[model samples]
Target: MSATFTEVLPARKSSKHSAIQWRPVTDDTHVAGVLTIHTDRASVAYTVSEFPTDWPGRGFLLAKETAGTDPESERYSVFCAAAGPWGDTCDCKGFTYKATCKHVDAVRALVGNAWL
Candidate 1:
């Protein structure tokens, strides 16, 4: 008789950015959703707090650039991936439109591309 033994349990999946020390935004700011996730996180408040965690364990400040007049205008909203509906998101217009932006890229580069 031929019999096949199935594994007792499936392998455990780990987050790539688990090393990142993410925090909650704790603000009323709203971010458009790009990714739809249903999985539950250990901390609902920190569900989006996944990414680079090697930063100096301190408070982070996001600077939102407002549009300028006169001749040139540079307007951009700094993305805060620390907290979001789906997590790993930015607040930039590009990210809102394409779900990706230079700010996000820069963070990925700074953190060695460890985003979930």
Candidate 2:
């Protein structure tokens, strides 16, 4: 006996914009892999991976006052610090005043490969 799976593709025309669809080619075989999709808003979607389940979604904000090489660059410094303890809530020192500060937005922009 084998297992099978199917994934529907999104409706985008551009090769860069088109969604990916995955399915098992065999009836008696099992396949496991990871799928990641990036969009205009820097959206990240992952499948069958420890990276997704372990870390999940997170945002970062760069410290404007601090001076250095700007580890995350200027565009993605929106979320330089953890919102809360382990990012549970947006209560970090960087977000004391504003709820959705520039740092948070920058963090959202730097998800996935951008972090690496």
Candidate 3:
């Protein structure tokens, strides 16, 4: 599935927006593959098997950051998929100060509006 969201601020000179592109992963390691925030950023790989076993009505997402141009540069962060007041969480560097990461944002954007 593929989707794009653009937040354009007329007052601002810069274009503020993000895009999410995901697809079902057939590999044994992951369930879905994705990229968020900007295409230049790393892709996020998701897996249902790793979801918190005790969390009800919730699943897990593992966002992996990879540089296609540089194969060795790769990293991943864990995230929780939940409903209601509780939102997604991630261990990515941005989460330390923002409490969320691009992975969570991408998932939210995917779930907040539609499906693939």
Candidate 4:
């Protein structure tokens, strides 16, 4: 599936002759379900939310770029898992896990056009 951008802005030039670059600080795997990015004048903090049935929530500050343009622009995109696992638990009595599973993956592919 194509990536979606929530915000877009023009790039800013730092020095009159120097070029600015827009770099992505997060990867698809890191921000699969991230809901927000908090930023200070110098840096940004990524806020990731977990499925209620999974592990604890997670957050991180981006230290480098993963992808994007040069001469940093204000435009930004958010990536979402197009598909995920779901359905009744498996019959295996010894297994116990929550959150989207392989079943959800199949459903997501049929519905969202891609898997997360």
Top-lDDT candidate index = 3
When summed lDDT is taken over every stretch of 10 residues in candidate 3, the lowest stretch is 6-15
lDDT of each: 0.31, 0.30, 0.45, 0.26
lDDT of 2 by residue, 6-116 (tens): 222333332234232222223222212222333333433222211222343443322222232323432222223334333532434435643443233323323322331
Candidate 1, residues 1-116, lDDT tens digits: the string is 22211111111242122222223234534321111111122211112322234433212223322221211413333334444322445554546776654444433432332322
Candidate 2, run of 10 with poorest lDDT: 45-54
Question: What is the per-residue lDDT of model 4 for residues 5-114, given as tens digits with 9 covering 90 to 100?
Answer: 23222222321222112223255545443222211223222233222233222112222233222225332222223232323232111113433222222223222432
- Give the alpha carbon lDDT tens digit for every residue of 1-116 in model 3: 34434421112112244455555444656455443334344333443234554654345445345443235524444444555425566655556676655555655555554432
Candidates ranked by TM-score: 3, 1, 2, 4
Residue ranges of candidate 1 with Cα displaced over 4 Å: 1-87, 113-116
- TM-scores, in order shown? 0.28, 0.24, 0.52, 0.18
Q: How well does model 3 score by local distance difference test?
A: 0.45
lDDT of 4: 0.26
Residue 86 displacement in candidate 4 (angstroms)? 31
lDDT of 1 at 44: 13
